[model samples]
Target: MKKISILVTAILALVFNACSTDDEFTFVAKPDPEGIAFMNTFLPSYILKPSNATNLAERFVWNEVDMDVQTTVRYELQASADESFQNMTVIESDIATTNQAVTVGELLALAEEAGLDTDPDTEASNSGTVYFQVRAYAGENPATTVEQFSEPVGITVELVEDTSGEVELPKIYVVGNFQGAGGYGSDWTPADGVPLAASGPAKTDYEGFVYLNVDKPQFKFLPTNASFDGDYGDAGETDGVFTGKLKQEGEKNAGTPDGTGGYYWFKVDTEKMTYSLTKVDWGLIGNATPTGWDSDTDLVYNPETKLWTLTLELTEQVAPDNGIKFRANDGWDINLGDTGADGTLEFGGDNIGVPESGNYTVTMDLSNPRDYTYTLVKN
Candidate 1:
């Protein structure tokens, strides 16, 4: 019986040893605290409030995450006029919060307490440009571990004019769209010489205007003379002299000899001060049709109008027959007027004028018949 007991015990010992040897264990490596994984920790995207206002404060909010271990988070908001964020002034720094998540309004209030502007409803005392950015911290070592930084946002405060004792003149000139003139030809010279005293009688046209400043009665061109060729006579009159005079304030008529090559010239005198001259072809004004027509297409300066009228003719019959369309650089649809006979359409709008001095495109739909494009530019 004792021998048998010993054998059973030996078998039990062998079984225990086999079980121990067959059992396997595994372990996961701990994340490196000072490695790139620490620097690449995830953070929430941020948004700013009062995006369009001059006097505005910033606010922020973040996503919430739950972990088995307790974690601490702090925030630092920085601002500067530059994008690099170097030497940025700290708007709010080391804002302590134990909460895993916070609302944007609460964050803004906290920022206010930390000496940030806070009052987005309030107007700025002065007008200028401002930029902003923010950095978030996770873990106990808030000083060195920044989870992420937000993209910068910028705002410009426009300056208000104080038009008290000052006289406001027309901001721009409308000089094209002449009635009895052709393309004004490709090569013409702009007349340049000393202003002749109101010779004989003063003349006037829809194209030119005079400004009388009493102290400086002079005429300035919308675009400088350097913009156009220096020729001012009939198309063929390379030698004929064109003459006109400035009578009063806004009157001046210069005559051009009648001919295919006849051109015209005039001078602007400002008592003793400096002045300039500008010219525009009348035929080049107004909106063009799908005929590929364009104003200033010849590289000439054409006056712009707050109102533009376009005429479209459709010779083909198609459902929703493609037509010309005008769009701002921002891709906003401009107003298109009514359609006349045979797909003829018109478009007009106020404040539809180009806001800046640059090149603009007018698109024509070639999917239909007689389709083309025209481009206009302002100098």
Candidate 2:
């Protein structure tokens, strides 16, 4: 019995020892990591230019792609003029809370809404160059964060000086009867006789020939003739007319009569203006056929006297369905008459015949009137 008891005790001791050893060498499960291993970063690739003369409405863009991470991501947009971003001014500290993926355009829009000037000029005013950086944070932990930065974008701001004082604005005058015979020429008068003066209201015995002055010699023919009916008419087709004549100070005596008083086609002396006429297109009236009117001859410019002479041979007047007109300034269409197809006939110097058949607004950027709208059409 004593030996059996001793054997039992030994067995029990060995079992206990094995249990202790197993417990000492046991494996433990490590805490599962909460965040993802791979993350995508986004940075701006391009910077947009700013408007001239005004420091408004500029933008920058960035793009970010989310890695199928489990944790939500937060984005921060930081900006600086310096690459180092040492003084790193934050144009947009907290832009928005976006999904794992976001577009730079959206971020830029946010920046704009946050009242940050993305314009290069505005940025340059504060700093020479602009830089952008984006950082993604995994929840509140810095350990699971990634950052990206963009290249340095810089702009050179120029201070524009006003040199307009060198050339003074010439005096402008409007010398035509708004209410005259409204065709091409009926009761038209030469602006040459009209001295340089401030622009104002004027009238004429004829129906629709009102003229306004530009800093340079310019005039506009309004359609106001009874026979006009706002449609195309010839020089001699109807009583109402709108025509321009150029005569020198003493050439009035030699003026040729075309049913109007004592004026020929108008002349512009380049010597007085310092610029020679290279091209001339009278705004065609109505939707005239065959386009332009018959030329007497190509108007010749006298460089010495700066005078344009109407010495060309006048052809048998073949009036277009529309009369050619002029604005107070060169290159601008005459806006005095109606501007719509029904209101006024459309005319354009760039009009082509046939397949491109349509009326076009005569667009001209005149130095005189800021905006001059006119039309040309094919009859």
Candidate 3:
């Protein structure tokens, strides 16, 4: 019995020693790391260059972080419109260097990508500040280290339009058998594609006309210079109007034209991400219409000036509200008239009054489809 008791005590002692042994390691959590500080406290003012600028504008610097261990650190420099960093845009990430320098071009792009603009440049509104901060993480794989972010620094940024004539945004062209010089399915060639007009500094508004023939059943829009990298096609409905927003390298759905195919105006507003296709056939229609609204006098298109021109004679006895109006397709569905008797025409507006009875040369300017204008001069 004594021997048995000794064996049990020895076993208990062995078990106690096993539990006390340092075989299993415990990770004592390190204190939260310290945030970095900007070596250059003030960031210089940034200006957007129309083209790529080579001069470095700002070089952000920060002190190294202490992770309580010898490990390589990865730094992520971030820029944001808000101080809270809710919608943070990382300028640089996974960088071993703590300092980051950006060029004038780079800074401008970042600001614009963040929905910042320079238009209506004013002291109170167009100008503002952007927040810059740094986040440091330790270790290479699994990123196993304490992470800390520096206090945000404010950088005054001035938003301005790039009028240097050196910048041109990506443009979309009408391709795929749009009744141009090439016949049909000519998506691979740039010469055959109809170029769309770009507007605004952002070039988000695209407008142009394409002469489509009835033989071709469909057409699509190419987002590049016939490179065909990103093209947007019919958005599943397969109708003449593709309401779906253009996506890069998206599905190729063709659009069907209406009215046996004619000159169709396409307006693409990237700001709104919407497109409209309208068939335009200008005609003089009203009580002054040559055939009393029964027949229409067509206006020829001038390719050089992008205006509709027509010369006709009118009598002293005015009929339709003492004037006439321009209608598309000889119908009232899309008609334009002068509201203030000014050169500009308002859609579905009042009749443009004639000053006197004479042969007049009327020119309607549709170069900028968003704003239509017309001029009537006595020949």
Candidate 4:
């Protein structure tokens, strides 16, 4: 009986070892994808924003990338101002598809999104180039395989002015006793005040940063550039709410700040007849900033220059990508970045990249809302 049991155990052990040996794994090599080609030809170098049909600009075609494996191959086209494709928008369907076409309207929107000013009325508005590249990958949706990118191709895009006769709104300026005798209110004249420019595309919204040095018991808005002919008031109220004549008529009263003296950002809406004053607290944040994309570092505001300033030393190890952005009140709701990568700051623009790692004296000029500039001086 013992010999029979031993024979059975020996037989089972031999079967297990045979199965394990057969299961040993071996790798299969798959060749990388190659020979990606753009099939579409004669792409328009420059195009105007399309108003109607027949304006479809270009159809991007590329030869299907071939890998040794026989699975599904997906393609994606991306466009960006930066050739590195650090920040890009997918040109065609985000899904696994090929042969994408862009219409004039679509191209214009992409141009604007890429930071080229599309406002034809502005003197700074101009045409610019955008970079494009195609990427091929294999596998299922949300592909896990490595992607191969084709060489980037660039094309120039032109911005067409809007001939729609957009309404031009009056610029608002603020003047008060808080500005002091020789400051914004020197000689008690209405012309000596801080000009409030339009916030964005809205015609009736105005905003600006001002210093209320003295205990400002009163302040008023001038509709004209430097005239008091048409102004606004708070109906003799000491609250932040503003009323009175936005243009050259009506009679309300003057408005006052909630507190006596401090740096403040005033936003007034002529269409809504409303106004708000928030204490300005600007900070820096981003992957390239000293705070490392998470925290905010305060920027000092110079009353005389009306600019936010910050001087800091940056290193390549920490700020590998030379990127930073300005955010107000330690929040992302109100932030500014370089749209054109041309030192001009725009709201919610691209990340501002530093030329090199060094001590930089950064200055943000908000004096002109229509034309904001950020100057970086390396020392």
Candidate 5:
């Protein structure tokens, strides 16, 4: 009887395993007909100006999309010169989030591509409309039928006629609790804050390096050096945004520091309305230095001058293959190089030319935002 029972149990287990394989399910997402909609409050019209080119054209937010079956949704944001979206340019692709930020500079590029000109002297209309659309789809390479595209939304962009050759680089000031450490003045004082340089002519993005002495130090962003009239606190989400209040009023976005802070890369995006602080240590690496492309030499930071300094010997280097770049934390994730060989540093730019093989005092000045520069002074 015992032998028979054992044989029966084995048979039952085998049958259950076969049934489970037969019931295997593969979830395929179906395109939702309702589609996605823009949730942002549209401006009457976008009057673009070179002076405020860095400002955000708009922060296009939308509700979460649906794909019927349970699966991950990928989004793509696009802009076109016409309502038909025949000649469209992708702004963001494969985004899991439901929001996208467009900058004036970005729009200017689109307008230029659309054959629209800001120069009133020309025949092209100074004012025109740009259409935007959002696409949601699934699977790595989804079929056309599985893609859900939103209805085209038009935004009017008027080019402000200007020949002044004036383009204001947008600036965002930082006021934090670790003020005295890096000559940042009194803690939490907007009037004594440091400026985070705009990434370029675009004012929506800003970046800079700062030293924070305290652990978990707190900070805030100010638009000007006068008062906290137009300031930003943490927006509650990670990698922060402006919540429109101050910490004194118990505003939660007091600023999230990288706990054990020393030297950090501070970045802010007004279009995205977010701020971030990344701790880093600056180093020099390249085939120009002693270690070639394998290692990095340390660079010292001065609080008073807010510059990175290093005095070392460099080898004579020829272009296209050999040279140096300023990288952080001994990694290639963040690095700066001279693209134009014009003393200005551009992120992931080309290699800088060695003024020849000799001992020189290298000075890296990132203190002034948007104007990153380096100097090689022979001893």
Candidate 6:
């Protein structure tokens, strides 16, 4: 019995040594954060042009990820519209090389995710930011592999699309008594009114947002930001939400949509000489947000900055194109979305998304006329 037990122990020892020093034993890789970083000099900002879409935007080079052992590794380049990596796009796909050439078109696509538009006709803001990072893994596939991510870098993207053949958009100004303390230089002066932008040079429709503190506040619109040569004002005695017509000459100032003013959406049609004002209170809703799609998470308005802000935890949606929207009065009648996935807002557009789940500060800035933009800052 002692001899048989000794034989079994010897056999077990031999089996352990056989698998220990070979492929049978998987190597555990340790990540080195200090040695991993971008080796390229990142530009402060890039002005992307559609005309140069096929050109090289940049060659992303990075230091080799130190795994503390000799082994093959996979490299993945990630680009995102938000700092939080909320909705990241893996460039091309996972690769083994330390560097990859990104084309102008690819960068432009990332800029679209950031909501930067060079087109003057679009209502979205023209400047935004994109973030990049490198992910290193030990195996061909990411599953069960030792993986780590490099520190992310942010780049500002300003779009300068080819506007050679396009018509230049027109400009209008709004000067109101509500602005009297001079957020726009002594409110009642058309020359000093807030800029109200037109959709296009051919389209005289102008839109903007404004806040009023006093009851019965009045205002007027000027065709130019610097002159009152042609201005339009109220044609009725009482405040008109939509029924009142605009008169170019010999008219009283346009009164508030309601006697009690808070915030309003302003619109004017130069051809029709018609103006409308709708009081709006903005809210955020979607599956990605805590409120889900059925209800709204109301955003607080900061009168000083004229921005709507909300801080909340957001969930990552792995499914494509499922995200969030900004609506007014907790309803879909007036909701804003980013159809182009650009940082700009359309009345009813595509869903906005995030890639990683985290706490974020969501801001909706409609203070600038026609150029509505929003920001999602991860905390």
- Cα miss at 83, model 3 (Å)? 2.8
Model 1, range 62-169, lDDT digits (tens) per residue?
332222123444555555433444544554555553212222322332223223342334443223333344444544432433254333334332222222532221
In each prediction, how many residue pairs overlap at the backbone (N, C-alpha, C within less than 3 A)?
Answer: 20, 50, 2, 4, 4, 6
Candidate numbers, best TM-score first, in rank order: 5, 6, 3, 4, 2, 1
Of the candidates numbered 1 and 4, which has the greater lDDT value?
Answer: 4
Candidate 6 C-alpha RMSD relative to the actual structure: 27.3
- Candidates' C-alpha lDDT: 0.27, 0.27, 0.58, 0.59, 0.69, 0.69
Model 5 per-residue lDDT tens digits across residues 1-379: 0000000000000000111357675555654555567777677667776555545678877767666555567777877765656777777777788887777777766666566665646777766666677777665642322566655455667777656655456676888778877688888787778888675443467788778767676677776667775567775554233343333223454544435658878887756766677788888888888888999999999988888999999988865467888998999898999886889998898887785999978899987777889998888
Per-residue lDDT of candidate 3, residues 191-241 (tens digit): 456666565333457776665655544666665543564466655543344
lDDT tens digits by residue: candidate 4, 31-124: 3435565666543455454332114467777766555444555666666654555676665533355576655544555555556664665654
Residues 25-61 of candidate 2 have per-residue lDDT tens digits of 4222221234212223322222322112111223333
Off by over 4 Å in 3: 1-81, 85-125, 130-156, 161-176, 182-208, 217-245, 257-260, 271-274, 291-296, 300-307, 316-322, 339-342, 368-371
Off by over 4 Å in 4: 1-169, 185-188, 199-202, 236-257, 316-322
Worst 10 residues of 5 by lDDT: 5-14
Please list the Cα RMSD from the true structure of every candidate, rounded to 1 decimal place.
28.7, 31.0, 16.8, 25.1, 16.8, 27.3
Q: What is the lDDT, from 0 to 100, of the residue 307 in candidate 3?
A: 70
| Predicted structure 6, TM vs. truth | 0.54
Clash count, predicted structure 2 = 50
Q: How many backbone clashes does candidate 3 have?
A: 2
Residue 186, candidate 4: C-alpha displacement in angstroms: 1.2
lDDT of 1: 0.27
Quote the lDDT for 147 in model 2: 34
